[model samples]
Target: MKKIYYIILLNLLTVTFSCSKEDDLEPTDIRYDYFTVSPDANDEESILRRKFYEDHNIHLLFNDTLRHEQRGTYADGTPHWFTELLDLSYDITSTKNETRFTYIRDHQKQKEGIRYAETYILPHLDKELRPYSIFLVETLEEYGWRWNTVAYYNGKRCLALAIQGIAELEEEEIKERCIDIFYNIVDSKTNYYDEELNDFIALGNKLHGETFESAGLSDDPTDEEIYAFGFLTWSTWYQEFPSESSDFTSFLKAVFYQKEEDFKVQYASYPLILQKYDIMKEVVKQKGYIF
Candidate 1:
């Protein structure tokens, strides 16, 4: 149901079933607001910290930042990450303080591995990809996790960030809308694109329609907006995809990690993934983000 020109990119990247051909719809230079987001984000951690202090710091007795120099950029510079090691001091309980530092120490190594593994691959991932970023585990776990959340940590970092390197209404406005890039959690609903909102918005859908073409509204929907049609799409997934869903996390593991060849079996929703890519690719192009 999402529309046209972007289909060219999806068609080339994915498969015939995954992407349909309706290659006539060209992009408009109208400067639509939703696709206009371009974050010149340099201070990732500081940006997140500020958001926490503003409205999310009520529970922690004490929390602070720690820095360590590493070997990678925030996907900008080719090799160095975490440019400096800042000496941070905090006065929380010993257990809490130790836990926090342990997390930092762990990420110093893990983030480096992630960089090494995906640095080359990301640049080739549809020019609009965001660098891989994960909210510091301490910050996310303490403030945002919903116990055993699946893609919450892995998928967004690998799949979503690659889909959202720079996005935030503003730096101080970083309400960890980081995940919102994956699915626009902030503005998700059951409505269609409200031209009045100056932003592309969506409301819920039953997804009872025969196909993605039928279930979806515009053929040009961003992946986030399509996902805004979550509850229904998720329900239908289990009926067709072999991936059985017990919870959100389980559903994610099944859908994201499933084999592509396997998606065509009995009830697979293969074309949907292709449609998701079309919207994401098109939006990024409109926003002028680099690959």
Candidate 2:
């Protein structure tokens, strides 16, 4: 039966995980000579993978190849750190998926918490290596885990352990980003509300200017800061686009809060902004920013 197989697989995973945990060893080789073809480094997938490699020195292989260059792969043929995270293969109940898939669906919660904590805990973790830096917290939130306060209450020990792993990394800027994400999650109204949601919206609009100012890169920022800005603007473009997440990324990129970065440089041959603005307006409404 599927249930029986699920149970058996979980038990095997437990034993394997225990052994892997005890080992606590880094990969023997950390270089990748193979090249998978990929588009320009500007591609989101390419950029994300490159940043991951630069920070952790861990190689990531893409599902497909682009040009002649290798997309990404480890020098040695071994499992990637991320792959290990997804490999737990724990089961979710058929009933749960029919409804909202809350982060803590079952015992798998304890398992993931333990794994993340043990691998990322300190002195291996850095003080600045909070969740936001690596993009995990936001990535999870976009899917609606509401992990902000829940993670702390449900898995404090594991949370501490994960932060520890961050402390050990060399990516200081990434670490800061992670910390910011942590605050943002905790600050989200759906997770935990310190005040009316609109207050946060007002705060976002008030500091909108910082979005352009922080863009240390040589360009002017619009109301939409980064893609996150777009996401945030989408969250509250007409209501509560905040100064931190959306506006901050725009400031970093030196663009208006409403600016769309997707096809800014290639507008000569085809029209992109007009279509993007239309999409943004729709997203803003759906997110309750316009209503």
- Top candidate on TM-score is 1
Q: After superposition, how far is residue 26 of candidate 1 from its true place, in Å?
A: 41
lDDT at 137, model 1: 31
* Backbone atom clashes (below 3 Å) for every candidate: 19, 46
**Where in model 1 is the C-alpha error above 4 Å?**
1-103, 106-111, 114-125, 132-257, 267-291
**Tens-digit lDDT track for model 1 on 1-291?**
455767876776778655575576777775422211124534543343344334322111111222334655556667664522212212243321111122333424434423422443333333334322223332222122333222222222222122122222354343233333433211121122323312211212234332445554454444454444433143344332111122223222233334334643422443444333334334433433323
Best-fitting candidate, scored by lDDT: 2
Q: Cα RMSD for candidate 1?
A: 24.6
The RMSD of every model to the true structure, in order and in angstroms, is 24.6, 23.4
Worst 10 residues of 1 by lDDT: 56-65
